[model samples]
Target: MIVYATHAGGRYLQLKDSLKEQPEGKRGVYVNLTNRCNCSCTFCLRHMKDMAEESSLWLREEPSVELVKDQLESLPWYYVSEIVFCGFGEPTMRLGDLVELLKYVKDIHPEVKTRLNTNGLSDLEYGRNTAVDFAGGILDTVSISLNASNAERYLALTRAKYGLKSYEAMLTFAEECKKYIANVVLTVVEKVENQEEIDRCKKICEARGLRLRVRTYEDK
Candidate 1:
């Protein structure tokens, strides 16, 4: 089920057969951009295995913008419901490439929804407000990782490069993202933290007209 795409006179193909199995209207394709990230969260599987090239996201190396464009171009048009920028790595690390790919996808399939599954450390990693860059992109949702409530607990969980600063930075980014993105969400892993943690996250998200999501810790 691999589909070939052409870009800059070069013919390239992207993997898609496995993704089509998702129920129609619930077809959410997860694209693994890279096996690189800034945070090495305890819950993250980056170090547990050869994750960059796995069954769910098959790739020897991160796909290029042209490669990603080719993959999206090969879709069955209506088989896909939502296209998520997610995988074993942080999609934002390749921000420019991702945005360009999203723009290309939206131009062709304007009805399909686009999303980013990120660790919310793009600002710290790039030393700029990354959310500001999503203004007109095809991105419909930004699902940020809100692993824990306080800084100490967060550091222990995420082992983020920036230490305690990562938590606050993510919150700030969520706030700024609400300005342009229609659906901005702060997601927390259950049990690692408690109701108090979820409550704090809700307060932060609510203050900025955003939503909070509590996802079951799947990697555990």
Candidate 2:
């Protein structure tokens, strides 16, 4: 599905189904642009979960910008507190489409917040300072996966296509995001790392002037 809401079982329900299930509440509406990613992270839910055909995030084809916009426009905006660019794949894989959609969201519903859940490798992926693209009030937050404390450990966890360079590039992207996005967060998943590692990751984020968020591993 192109658009879905996070459900209790770590399963995602299509927007229409989501509305039917829980019609009222402040929730994030996630946009699935494509099933393409530049990294194969060891703990990513895409590899761990086995979803049925209807709820599967593995898209048969990437949706066009207009198609994604249509899905967003159809949603119950009153119930949505935030619109996130995230799914089975890294949203930055389609950076142009992602930004355009963010613009579209603000154009129609200026009050609804917008965010991106990314691996923080867009600079390496696009060979440019992609943070500049997020300038203006289009994006409110950028949550980047900073899975490890150092480069070697990070490379091992993410197995990013860019190799060892991926770690540094990700950190650099997070740093740059601070200048553009309002809330720049670097995240590490719990259960994947020990206390010492989490502390060390916190130091890394602090040194970079960013916040660290410990995401719970949702194994459902």
Candidate 3:
């Protein structure tokens, strides 16, 4: 099935294709928020694909809460098991809108799982504890990127605008997320050298009462 987002709503484009396209048993939907981001990760698919703008997600601009709600309303209930906030860019860039949309979706389909894949810098970005708002909402899981063990390596990987401090900021966000989100995850990109770093990342997650998720590095 083809999941397309537009001003009117999230719509099924042409459903003649394979349904088992996305892994992770996610027969759900993917929502693209905005193309803006605080970091430009070296491994990011945004640089490798055509989804470099909000417009490419078929949005004239960032969708309003009503617009996104309308899209979610049109979705077939059975085909969706989850609703994911993950475009090529940072979903939290449109933090308020994302939260609003999540509330709207949950009101209609409370059983449908909802998730967010982020760089884990929302605290720094929004200057507040954003996780608290997600506590009892549609959000089920939150995946935060922890690319490297050290600040230098993290800076190198993400090329973040926040400098070396972004690593610490991300860890701090993950720590706070544990108190708010039921499933708070710290993810490290897998590579030869990242094995040891991944171990270190696990330790960090463990200390913060969170889980570690090792992601496969695609050579984009």
**What's the distance in Å from true for residue 169, model 1?**
1.0
Model 1, span 1-220: residue lDDT tens? 1232212222122424333332334356667687678889876655544443444444567777787777777667666677788776788889998888778778888888988889899999989998878888578999998877678888998999998899899889988888778888889988667898889878876776778899875441
- Candidate 3 local lDDT, residue 162: 82
RMSD of each: 6.2, 1.4, 5.0
lDDT of 3 at 216: 71
Q: What TM-score should be assigned to candidate 2?
A: 0.96
Shift of residue 16 alpha carbon in model 1, Å: 5.7
Specify the highest-lDDT model's number: 2
Cα lDDT computed for each candidate against the true fold: 0.74, 0.89, 0.73
Better of 1 and 2 by TM-score: 2
**Cα-based lDDT at residue 206, candidate 2:** 87
lDDT of 3 by residue, 1-220 (tens): 1144211232233212224333223265777776678998877766644445433454456666666666667766666777888865688988888888888778888988888999998888878877787877568889998888789989998999889888998998888777767788888877724567788878877877778888876543
Clashing pairs in 2: none
**Which residue segments of model 1 deviate by more than 4 Å?**
1-26, 47-59
